[model samples]
Target chain A: MGPVPDRPATSSRTPADRPATASGPGRVLIAVYAIFAVAATSRAAVQIATRFDEAPVPYALSAFAAVVYVLATFALARTGPTWWRVALVSCSVEMTGVLVVGTLSVFDRAAFPDATVWSNFGMGYLFIPLVLPVIGLLWLRRTRPA
Target chain B: MITGYAIAVAACAAGVAIWAFVLVVLHREPEKPLLMGVGALEALLAVQVVISVVMLIGGGEPGSMLTFLAYLVGSLLVLPLGTVWALAERTRSSTAILGILCLTVPVLLLRMVEVWGGASA
Candidate 1:
C-alpha cells in the first residue's frame, strides 16, 4: 500500500491558492449540495418509477428538480468560467423552482396530492431547498474570480 | 424496522453530531475522539444493515424493498465517506461537514423506518 499521507499540513494549505468556490467553508457547502443531489435524484427516480401515473405533475417536477441539483452540484465542484456560469444558472433556476412550486402547492393543493422535494418551500426537508440556493448565489458572488 | 434500534442509532448520531458541532465552534480540526465517535456510530449502522437484511430474508415486508435497501446502504456510507472528505481538507469547515454527515444519519434512519411500513405524516 502507499504511504499514509500527511493529514493536517497538506490539507490545511492557505485558501489563497485554492479555488475559492470549493475551498474551506465552501467544502462544507459542497458537501451539503452533494447530499441534496443524491437525495433528490434517488427520490425522483423512485417516485417516477413506482407511481408516476398517480401524480405525474409532482413527479415530473421532482425529476426536474433532481436534474437541476445534479447540474448545480457538478458545476459547483468544477473549476472554470464555464462551470461558474453553469452554477449561476442552475442556482437561479433552483430558486425560481422552489418559490413557484412552493406557492403553487399551497394555493393549488389539488394539483399536488403527493409532495415533491420543493413542496411547501421544502417543508419536508426542513426548508433546505428554499435556503440552499440563496447560500449558493452568495458563495458564488463572494468567490467570483478577480 | 426495529424501533428500539432506530432510536439508539438516532441517539448516537445526535451525540456524534453534537461533538462535531463543538469541534466546529472551537475552530478545531477533526481529531481522534471525533473519529472514534463516528466509528462507533458506523458500527451500529453496520449492525442495523445486517438485522434489516435478515428480517427482509425472513419475509418482513417493507413498503418498498429497493428504497429500504437504498437507505440501509446509504446509512452505512455516510460516515466513512464524510470522514474521508473531511480529512482531505482538515479545516473548520471539514468539521462542519462531519456534523452535517452525522445529522444525515438520523434522517436516513427515519426514512428507513417510514419505508419499512412505519407511519409517515
Candidate 2:
C-alpha cells in the first residue's frame, strides 16, 4: 500500500462525518437514550437513597437500566468499532433486562412490590423501554459494516 | 404547585409537541416561531420552578424533596438541551428532537405536580 494521506484531526469532524449511528434518525435514538438515562438515574438515585430497605431489587435494577442507557447513548454518539461493540452489548443487556424483569414483575408481584424501568416490560413507560432496545438492535444491524 | 399554572404549562407543552410534528410533516426545520413557542413554555416552566423553591423556603414539603428537585431541574433543562442537539444535526430528525423534548416536559411537569401534592398532603 502507498503512504496513507495525512489524517485530519479528529476534533473538527461533525456527526455527519462519523458512524451511521451519529446521523439522522440515530441522533433521535441518542436523544431518547439520553432521556431514559437521565430519568432512570435520577429515579434510581432517589429510590435508593430514600427507601433502599423498602425495595432493593427494583431500585437496583433501575440504576442498572440507567447505566446501560448511558452506555448506549455514549457509544452511539462516538465513532469506532469499539464503541459499536459497546453499543451492541448495552442494547442486548437492556433487552434482556426488560424482558426478564417485566416477566418476573408480572407473575411475582411480591418480588417487585415497587416498579422498575423494566417492570411489566416497561408498561409504565408506554412500553418504550421494551420497544426501544428492539429498535436499537435493528438500527445497529442496519448500520453494521460489511 | 400552582394548579391552573400546571394545567397551562402542560397544555403549552402539548401544543409545542404538536407544532413540532407539524413541522416534520411539512418537511420544515424548526422555524423561529417554533423556537419562540418553546421559549414561552420555558418561561412558564421557570415560574413553576420558582413556586417550588418558594414552597420549600416557606416550610412547604414534597413527599420526596430530592426527587421533586431533580425533576424540577430536569424539566427546565430539557428544552435547552434538546434545542442544542437539534441544531447540531440540522436535519429533519433534528426537528423531531424538539417534539420529543416537548412531549417529555409535560410528563415531567405532571410528576412534579404529583410530588407537590404529596408534600402538601
lDDT tens per residue, model 1, B78-108: 8888788777777777778999999999999
Ten-residue region with minimum lDDT total, candidate 2 chain A: A1-10
In order, what DockQ does each candidate have?
0.33, 0.35
Model 1, A123-144: lDDT tens digits are: 9999999999999999888666
Q: Would you list the C-alpha lDDT of every candidate in the order shown?
A: 0.84, 0.83
Please provide, for model 2 over A1-146, each residue's C-alpha lDDT reduced to its tens digit, 9 standing for 90 to 100.
12211222332233444436776678888999999998888888888887899888788888999899999999988766687789999999999999999999999999998888999999989999999999999878866644
Highest TM-score scorer: 1
Please write out the lDDT profile of model 2 over residues B32-89, one tens digit for every residue: 8888998999999999989878878999788778888888899789999889997786
Give Cα distance to truth, residue B45, candidate 1, Å: 0.3
> What C-alpha lDDT, on a 0 to 100 scale, does residue A142 get in candidate 2?
61
Candidate 1 to truth, TM: 0.91
Worst 10 residues of 1 chain B by lDDT: B112-121
Give the C-alpha miss distance for residue B60 in model 1, angstroms. Answer: 0.5
